[model samples]
Target: MARLNMRRCPQSRNPSSEKIIDFYAGDYEVNDSPIEQVKLTVPITDNPSEPVLTFRTWVLGLTSCALLAFLNRFFSFRQNPLSVGPVAAQIIVLPIGRLMASTLPTKVYQCPLTKWRFSLNPGPFSVKEHALITIFAGCGAGGVYAVHIVIILKAFYKRSLHPVAALLLAQTTQLLGYGWAGLFRKVLVDSPYMWWPQNLPQVSLFRALHEEQERPRGGVSRLQFFIIILVSSFAYYTVPGYLFPSLSALSFICWIWTDSVTMQQIGSGLNGLGIGSFGLDWSTVASFLSSPLAFPLFAIVNMLIGFILVIYVMLPIAYWTNIYDAKRFPIFSCETFDYSGQVYNVSRILNQKTFDLDVGAYNSYSRVYVSVLFALNYGLSFAGLVASLSHVALFDGKHIWQTWGNAKSESEEFGDVHTRLMKKYYDPVPHWWFHACLITSIVFSLIACEGFDKALQLPWWGFLLSVAVSFIFTLPVSVITATTNQAPGLNVITEMIIGYLYPGRPIANVTFKTYGTISTNQAISFLSDLKLGHYMKIPPKSMFIVQLAGTIVASSFCFGTAWWLLESVENICDKNLLPEGSPWTCPGDDVFYSASIIWGVVGPGRMFTSAGNYPEMNWFFLIGLLLPVPGWYLARKFPTTKWLGKIHWPIILGATSKMPPTRAVHFWSWGAVGLFFNYYIFRKYKTWWARHTYILSAALDAGLAFMGVFLYFALQGNNIEGPHWWGNSNGDHCPLATCPTSPGIKVEGCPVF
Candidate 1:
């Protein structure tokens, strides 16, 4: 084996200089590419002369995440049924799941098909190992199946898809995502300035796993986790989703309302609602956009304000003024007070977008919000960069400079031979690689999408317009989402785009009319991946592959599943099926509309006339737009701030899904739990108990995935076309036309007539 070289230095007595030099010394290397390392490792492994991870181990690692994904989809208790929705859940669950498996004797890794055909020596419950598997599963089989089961099976009135096909789709998608990521590992991961914060948790876990192996083993505990997932899944399938609704408090409430129609219509729909259901209203979302309470401490405050001003304040005002709905003042279209004090058409109002800003009613709302947020975020993110550097300059500036200089240093385990070889043959790819990869991926995606009949039917000019819109919209949107975590601004950007390009098309018609507009969403999602890579210490090159893999996996299946689920509907009565009022009813529409509307309305701004005036609501949406900044600023001021720093903003950012009355308490509580587990359980009890958090999380996710899958299949209940439960069907319940109906299904009185 070749050796890595360490740079020798003259003796220095100055402590500050010494520290800086030493810190960065390791970063300096002749060659820093992981791809080259891969090539070298390949030769060694293929020689049959050097020890390497066996094929069986590779398969075991790969399949583990898949298995977990399947379980999560089938057994979920959250909106993201696969339980991979929240980053915190992933961090907490995956390790625990793996640890649970770890404690289960050799049978855990046993191949279900061949049964212990091959095995590798133990590596501790590895964060990297399991995470890779989870991502693989998520991107591959999980991604595809998620779409397929939700769309095709449910749409066709089938209970489920062929198991083999589901698995194949999942695997293929994952592979593709990884392949794409591989092309841009350098910029996303290797760049020092680009450390994605979300990745740090994973890196810490991975490093700890390796370090812990040297310590005595008390073994990982899986009791609480294992039982939780099992019980959760069982409960999910047995309760509202499968068996008739039964809840003591709810039952009492129902009794007070003797009207079965109201009860059946309203209460029946409760099953599909999650904790975040309360916050889905325009007021809540708008509030979040403008509130400065939610901003990160380290992020600049002014840019956030600007963003809020544009979307929450400006666009809402615009849209409400007659942009989209000429005759309405943006009230809940379905909100009707009963003459006798009984609710009439309550569902329609609940179903309609509030203030005409609902993503469903007017495309402008989504576009304007996202666009302004993106622009604001892009502008504000620069401040974050300044903040980060200034913070470092004040504190760890020396260390950063050292790390920068050390990029030329040799690997610790390697000697001169390896170092020389690395210098000669391996070099870390540059940041430009990602730019190139982005271009290529876009091209390929366009090509692939063009092959689809519906997508291909788009005019060539429309396709070019879509790309232009995506390029214009996604960059800023990605920056905002990345820096602030709240992307309410996307709404504005999307509306502007759609309103400009496909001017008279219904918001629903944009996807069919524009071939590649959705790429804006994809770009942002991809950028999030890169953001994650930056935080973690994973090699930039390695991260490129990992992220690309996940993306490819997601892309391959996301659209298909979205399409299927949107088109499929089953029992209209089943709340889990496209409930009378839920965003999931129109799965892809919000995202697609966000882009199309932007192109149509804002892309040309004053130049191109719009079909209708955009609606205007209150400027309250600007509140949360600034909220994230203060918090970010405070964080930057106090990087070592104990309680706050311990709270991973990524998770908190995700928690924005929760409504305000509940958001603060939930965020802090969850943060408390996470911090306690990470610091106390994992760190303090480092010997055994806490190390397997990811494994546990994986198991939980698996259970969740399984439940979600089950709901998608079984809940349809033989109905082929009623309402799509998974996404954007815009109908309540299953999409099936002939779903079983009860007398209570009739409206109390028709108000629409």
Candidate 2:
């Protein structure tokens, strides 16, 4: 219950003024150390005549985007999903660009009417073109999220959804955020204080790629260092990525107590508390939580505190106390359960004709339940959402207010160096263009949701409501992401609202949640990319075009790949009909389907109200609302204690928000690496940390991505499985970690009593 590490003192100065003050251990050219480093990575120079959106950029960008989309869609279903981000394309396309520059004919070509001219190959692939292509490929790196609705509807619900309807749904959801992105440009992108910490690594990588080979101060150059680590990481990943999978998480406690189910449950990294667990795989270390090296020291520290409080402390207490019959379910699971700890049969409570919940069948069957871990995550998420708003209002209110007041009157007066340079050189993307995109998307979203057969189930009013919520939440969420590299979302809250308003309408509820949540998230993503472009001095109009084009291309490729797999592959996502050890399990979609049932069909009234098992869980909202009070008071009381304001409650609570999909080992390993690089190296060897930390992160990602894709096509796709051995089997060597501890529960793979 004690959330803050507080030392109460006499109230003196205003907390609001004290919040922005900080003391630095080392000298900084600017108030922000990270932004000062931006001068090092991002060049202050600009070449106005460089060819951007050239023939090479268009062709390579399109090809890379399509390929990345296909791979993400295809590989996402496997046991260990391989996400080939734009980083690989950024590295791979360089040599190809060089070759094209040297080989292709340089004959000039002109458009029929306009002064626009092009060639088969641009002179040399300038860093601008390289950045554009990489940004374009980024459009499809993770695959479209809205495709999940199509998945549950067809695969799980067995409903016949037309391909055109599916296509419309995908495109609209993905494109709905352009307006929001445009509107927030002044606040999120143009301002100097909104330094997006996440995009720094990508900027660093681009600079390293263009830097000539030269070892500064008798040390390896950035280019040489990247090559060395890239090769080493590629070679090392073979052990955990293929040859031996258990190296991902070495559950030493489970290894020591081989026969004890309790011990395994207490120690397993993948499914349990991860008491003595460790990992060697880069994928395991950085998969769920992204590369730890990319995050700043303050953010990492906040996340670690949150992770420890939730995973190691509260999770154990909740389980051991047997609260809400915790012993009857697995230590960590997203699956809903019944009284006897059996997986709830969702079909049993559904009305076949109307696709609504059957009240009669529901009365006969048992009430639903989630694991203690899942329940806690939901509560913490509730807290995280409000705390973010409160934290931002208290800490960042003044800067945001000032930005809003004079953001347009005079750009040069209030802007930073990057903003000044951008404004002086390039024509800004007109505000009206963004307004048109927003309005048009809203009009089209209505048609898409309610147009064809009315299949999407979301009404016009509901879609408008979703937009309202998205509009309201974007600024706060963006502020959180812009500063701390963490985005607090409204996903859970959106579902809860719709589930209460219109219960037993699964598709409608999910559709509302998707638009409400992802619009904000997508806008934030676009903003991040824009900030990357800002740092690198890519023209705003060109960046805008690439983002739009990449989104359209990515959507098409995702739907095409998914539809093809659904048709050609036999019994996809059906484990019962597939051969032994088949990898098309659809774990993510299963979780999505469960959400539809819990918040859609079952409704929060029956599940989290008086009729439900966990009515008290709603109290988390109030708990989260007030969690930031103590920290603010302390900051105000002791203005000189600079670190007091750094206790970001939102980030700490949101740290473990992704726990079900992510395991305890993810945090443990991420923190381990982050401490070494961001904390220890950052303070001890600032220069080395600055040069090599981001290089190490980029190299690791690029190496694993290339190797993972190569392994899939070269080996796994051919049914050439890893050798049959102990190291390749039984992850974490903790088979019984998922077993329920209750006697006579009769759950599969558990003890009888």
Candidate 3:
């Protein structure tokens, strides 16, 4: 309970500071630098005495968390899963903060017993308090991906779980990441070079909102522009989102050739590759790929190149060429199939008593078949894994080593201006605090893994091993993400390890992967938020408290929402059980369940090794490792070729990161928007790009999220249908999108009432 005195650094005499030197000097030159020149010149203060844990922060933070958790979980069940990102929370909470600041009682009120006296108003809603609210909302924004485990069990696998047990599973998995974030705060948050490039926009938005004294020369101020965009986006969403739903996926090609199976496969957004498709909906554009308007131009270009090469060029060639008789299946799908082109009957292959695979039944059912695109996704994942390691080593090893070597130095010369400013104000959260959380998290995980039937059958040693793996990979992943805005996930690695260690236990495999991979990802994300706090000068202790509280609140809401959806949505995952063209297809759960089968039930040995049917996929790891070598060598040999240095293999491989749930058209559309703004607009109007890009993104996201929630409750949630029309009908547009061209495969059609 130690309080640190916060102080602002004296403003430098130079009004226009052009250059600021730091230890990682060249790292930012390639992409958007976290410590921009504009930020250094601005006079900002870190006020540590500001009330951050006041009633306003808690009320607004919890409310935002509850709403975001519920909405994100609800959307996850949809065919096109969308998430309410942290940026949305960051933007929406600003007005709420201002409202609280204006209406709350100014007089101090004392607690009944404790010596705590705090004002509900807390004097003008400090930036730290606003950030604390965002941190809480962020904890709930994505609604704990691990909760899908319980959902998949109950909804897809027909194994019901106790609500309390489900909540604990979600809470423990999420909080484990917080422990890792706490442990790595020094390396990932305190370090000057750990900029976490994605967080720059949020930081920029914070400064624009709180720091600006007078309106700029531009006709519209940032705040005014943001509000306008938010209102405009919200109004526009009603058309594509609910009324004229066809606008969400406008495929002109499908309209032209409605009966052509080939065209439908290439053009349909809902069922196929979505080649010529376009969405009027901003939410559709940003759903899986994220807001492209926020990405750096160079990164977007690299991803686009890779996406086109893989999905458009390579996948089609492989499918049409009948690689693995791929023509027998749909060109793009996550569902597993039998060799006879029928949906794979998982229940038939599983033992009735023990959830293990029945050898005789499995042999009789024939080898499980995967769509070519699905198999290729695994290959790309393998490539991405090795490519990330090699790319980071070749490009970032020197800077990482240098930063580590100078870790003990408190010299301002080695740190960014923000880091130096922070040093003057607040002390970093104590390491013991992180260790305590880590120990507690481990205890909870052990109890869950051992005590609950719904929980995994993972041993204590296995749980520790997952944590150890997370620790080992955290630094490298953090470094990559901090610099380039990309982190190759630990999913494949974790699943492979656990699959080898404990085969035939699908629950244990997924649980281990959840703890190992998701924890690392969540830790990096939390650290990124902390770095944002550092830049904004939020007290470390307050950030910690809000994050922990938010995670707990999010867990409860997400679990409850998921449970409610499962109970109401009949035959959630089974297409045969639901009405045709129902939006509630559970694609995310399909992908998750498919992974469980591939890695957990069948085991990695049978999927990638010589014993497996698809042994050729093992070559991708070597290919990924070697892919970056030539680029690195060329950059070293000819240093002047700037483009060579920017050829990031990890970004290229990451283009296929979410293939199942995300279509090729999502990348195409995202790349187009990124090109329009990040590439063209950024070069033409740097100031406008800096000022408006993130605000625009935040506004659009907030609008979409809020409208989606409203529409769901007003119409979909209550089972109240809008007026029936072609525009409002299931917007597939193309009946033959999922029809198989290969002989002996059954053809499908859209519902025509």
TM-score of each: 0.47, 0.94, 0.91
* Each model's backbone clash number: 208, 0, 0
| Candidate 2 lDDT by residue in tens digits, 290-353 | 9888777788999999989988898889998998899999889998988889988889999988
Our tally of clashes for model 2 stands at: 0
The superposed Cα distance between candidate 3 and the true structure at residue 682, in angstroms, equals 0.7
What tens digits encode model 3's per-residue C-alpha lDDT throughout 463-561?
Answer: 899999988887778877876676788888888899888877677888889999988887887788788777667777777778778888998999888
Where is model 2 more than 4 Å wrong at Cα?
1-34
- Candidate 1 residues lying further than 4 Å off, grouped into runs, are 1-127, 141-491, 506-554, 557-703, 706-753
Stretches of candidate 3 off by over 4 Å are: 1-49, 79-82, 86-92, 109-116, 162-164, 211-213, 216-218, 453-455, 567-570, 579-584, 729-732, 750-753
Estimate candidate 1's RMSD in Å: 13.3
Candidate 2 vs 3: which has more lDDT? 2
622, model 3: CA deviation in Å?
A: 1.2
For candidate 2, the 10 contiguous residues with the lowest summed lDDT are 13-22
